[model samples]
Target: MSDQQPTGSDLSPPGESTSDTSPSRTAQLKRWAALDTTSGALLLTAATIAVVWANSPWRDSYQDLLEIEFGPAALHLHLSLADWIADGMLAIFFFVVGVELKHEFVAGTLRDFKLAGVPIVAALGGMIVPAACYVAVVGIGDPEALGGWAIPTATDIAFALAVLAIFGRGLPVALRTFLLTLAVVDDLLGITVIATFYTDTINLPALLGALVAVAVFAVLVRMARRWWLLLLPVALTAWTLMHASGVHATIAGVLLGFSVPAVAMRGERMPRTEWFDETIRPYSAAVALPVFAFAAAGVTVVGTSGIIQPVSIGIMLGLVVGKVVGVLAFTALMVRFTPLRLPDSIGLRDLLPVGMLTGVGFTVALLIAELSFEVGSDSHAAAAKAAILAGSVVSAAIAAVLLRWDARQLRDPDMNRDGIPDVDRDVIGG
Candidate 1:
């Protein structure tokens, strides 16, 4: 009956060590890195199409397409294309995120609270500071704009990782690991905010139904039975009820993901969580995320003036300025004043670019923006979208330059006669 999990490294066959140099381990890492890069490219392409379609002469068609609604209204399923992308397809993406989060907690660096505390605290500072910066700028002038404060608190991991994979070829592994951890924690916080603040009136009966379904799903998963045919309907039912219950449907994805076992049973070859992740991750990244980006990122910029509104300015500053300052400052303070220590392979200077990369608040930020403003508030929505796009681009540019500089610095002579460069050795060992 116990679902308690072993660490990730323990998922390997009982006789094999989880050495990075192992052919299987290296191949797995390469596959994941390749997938990340491909997803990033897909996201960029989708985002580009959205922006172009939004501003082109055929913009009306784009709007019409998104607004086109179908499905059974009686079942509370009638929704626009945009809504389907956000509420339906993005659930798949979040499910993968949930799997990754569970893996990290069960076996990754986050398995140790002392090692994990740095990024956890950095994520907190990252979220809080951007929110404060956003509110301070827009909330003071227009109280109604305060709702958008959460928009800047998100960090788009796919976009950020794309930048790292391109520019951080020779950088320390610890840097990428740190960024991944930070972004995951940030997503957790953003989801919490959505479930807590963005939700309106709740339907308690529907919510109770959803919770019951979730419990059932968890029990079935714990049994290690291949009941996807049955479980799929239960999952969808939970998601539908959650949607009807005034909670975001993606939360259903996370809850369902948590139910899957993270460790293999005695006769199993792989953990169910890892197996599910490997099977579903491609669809999540290559299909679900791109579609969501295409639906969500299209915002017509009227002109430069639209991009300079108080709300837009607040979003831009919060993302580009507040994120970097908050992450770096808090990380430094913790290492200096507390018992926490930075990973040996990474130094304070390295975090500057890492902090900057955290500023790319693309996907989830867009979702928050949508929730923050009324549909009729076209001006505000357009402005905020412009700010998110601009801030992310600017942050990526800065992070690229800083990472290149760091790579160059790592080229210094290696006094040790080891075949591997000192920097590489440090990164791999760490």
Candidate 2:
């Protein structure tokens, strides 16, 4: 089935519309993209600085800051800076994820399952087999460690999109679509993992409070017709309640994201000059994602002493090796034996390295590390951080190089695959 493109103002939620042809609309989009890129660049720079500082004489200060405790008198919440990023800033990331998820389901790619099949299958392949491999090898003895299994189950959306952008027009548009689809499914899996595995011994009061918030949010969403400013405050309240309830605060972010009404602004008309979604959604993607990336990507790496510990080794290997093997192997088998053609632009050769790149699990890996790190095992947590750093660096470098090579091939202008020209090929390769 061909994917349904969102169109016509009738689909607009009541009041959302704008003049798409206006120069202002284009300028707004450009601004949004600029914000995304700048924030993304900052994140990359911050991560690099963290790595350098962790190894330098400033390493002590770096470690100290992350470990420094700050909280209140009566409530007495204590956590390191790293923990603050992992558990706190990350909730915002999940909140965004929830928004994206809702958008897709309501109006975007997953609007039809057949159109969504390729990436859905690919993401499932990417997640399930790696986890099975991890559990089979070392999962027999400790069930607590089972929480770590979900670590390899996600794809880093920012990194994937960055890789695609580098390839430019040499890749297929379908590739981006497929990758986006895959990441969405992959994130959903990660959410399930957190909900099912990473919770503290359940607290009834907290759960009840969460349920109440969810109910109230739903009621507000349905009844309140205006594009309400209440979203931010309500989301914050939900985050606090989730935190207090002992549920992962990040989940609260997701729930709040869902509650945010996508209702059209008041005094709007169908098929108007501006579309509400196109206007507001890109800001989240371009600005919010990159900031989250920069804030979450950095992990101070000092003292090589315990950096190569067993848990670290497992995580690194799982992300670097496990993702590639599982995703590629499953995809290969599916295309080979079944009717689903390998995306027309990707042959077995090109697919191999792309699979390898999917292993570049930076953002998701950090999230899983936070979820896995139980109380008092700071060293274990540190090891997980080190492993993510090492694995992501290696995966990103290798994948970037290989993708560049493939992109060059697709861009040669002289070569065509099975009657398809280079320009068309580039879009697919993306």
Candidate 3:
């Protein structure tokens, strides 16, 4: 979390770790943070454009564009632009996620169990409560809609961090770190859910082929030679096989990422994994994600009837109400009952807004909604999209207000000017 060099040999590779002296690595991370903020803006713009196009008179054109397919048909690779974006481009995003997760678990804050426990528990609670809420609302009457329980369990890292950057200028650095850790854990859980629950019928031969390709990729990367050229073909082959194996092709990206070494060689200035993330992160954030949002976020609202459907209400409640309640309650329980400790700069009150901000489940929620139901066709899918958009917007708005107020409280420790910091008085019910 401090961006300091890692200490343990288990985290570092065979040679000396370059984490401390790698100026290029630090610069790349800075660039990534800056681009992450910009990408959030771009994603919102793309989603807005999709909504307008979907609701406009030329909505048919949007559907036509999404349906256009142009991949090689012989290999069963022919897919719509939307499918390519979801399955191919999104792999790049998940690859970056895998890199970050590896870094966290191996050398970052998560390497210390004490430091990792809080966010990990918070993320688990955040995921479980929302899913429970969704099922409670939609499962009894419509079991088919239960597939979308995972939709609200995600936290859009870019969007949530963008809001923090915009509204949390004077807040403690610990808050940002907490949010990052929580989001990272949230992503890991989401990935597990996708791989475990969403996978359909397995193709044993294709899956075995994918494993072979991945093994070859791992060996090639360990050689630390000009493996990119060789690995590219191997990666593609693996992806194709995974696609054919009924497992999501994006899992291939995470697998390939984990195969890369997290520590630098004796002479190298940066880890291969860091370099790869630096190079590909921009493409994923700026182009891949925005394109996916454009393709996936468009939803035609049929009327009030569609908007009030159980799926719509369930997603909304799961995101807006369930997320906030779950994150805050679980975090408080952890601090009170467990050994987890909050940073001195952060207090119980500070987490309230952070919990609410976790509700802004935009990008991944939309992706899961698409996976949950028929895309661009099912009435339920349309309602789910509408709910995701609406719920994200409402959550963002509420978090903005709460964060702004918290910022003010940080700036002025005493609201009534009667001395005795206002936060203590409020907490004590004075």
Best by lDDT: 1
In candidate 2, where is summed lDDT lowest over 10 consecutive residues? 1-10
Q: Write the per-residue lDDT of candidate 2 for residues 1-430, one digit (tens) a residue.
A: 1121234332345554545534454554444443423434545666777667767877767667677777553532576665666667777667667766766765567767655665677778778776775565446534445557777666777666665555534655656666677777788888877877888676778667876776676566545356246645665666666777777778876776565444333454521112323333345445455444544444555444665655666677777788777777776676666655444455655655566667767777677777787423565666666777777778777776776677666333323133444343436423
RMSD of each: 6.0, 5.4, 6.3
> All candidates' lDDT scores?
0.80, 0.61, 0.79
Q: Ten residues in a row with the worst lDDT in model 1?
A: 1-10
Candidate 3 regions with alpha-carbon error over 4 angstroms: 1-34, 302-305, 411-430
- Candidate number achieving the greatest TM-score relative to the actual structure: 1
TM-score for all models, in order of appearance: 0.88, 0.78, 0.87
lDDT of 1 by residue, 1-430 (tens): 0112233454344324566543455445434533667778989899999999988988879889999999889989999988888899999988877887887788666789787888889999899999999999997766778889999999998889889878987777767888988899999889899889999889999999999999988877666355555788999989999999999899989888877777777467667777667656667777888999898888876443555788988999999999999899898889878887766467677788889999999989988898888653466888888899999999999999998898767433332223334453444222
Relative to the true structure, candidate 2 reaches a TM of 0.78
As a whole number from 0 to 100, the lDDT of residue 11 in candidate 1 is: 37
Q: Give the TM-score of candidate 1.
A: 0.88
The better-scoring model by lDDT among 1 and 3 is 1
The window of 10 residues in a row where model 3 has the poorest summed lDDT is 1-10
Candidate 1, residue 408: CA error in Å?
1.6
Give per-residue CA lDDT, model 3, range 248-324, as digits (tens): 88888888877877777647666767666665666777787888889988887633256678898889999999998
Record all residue pairs in model 3 with backbone atoms less than 3 Å apart, i.e. clashing. Answer: none
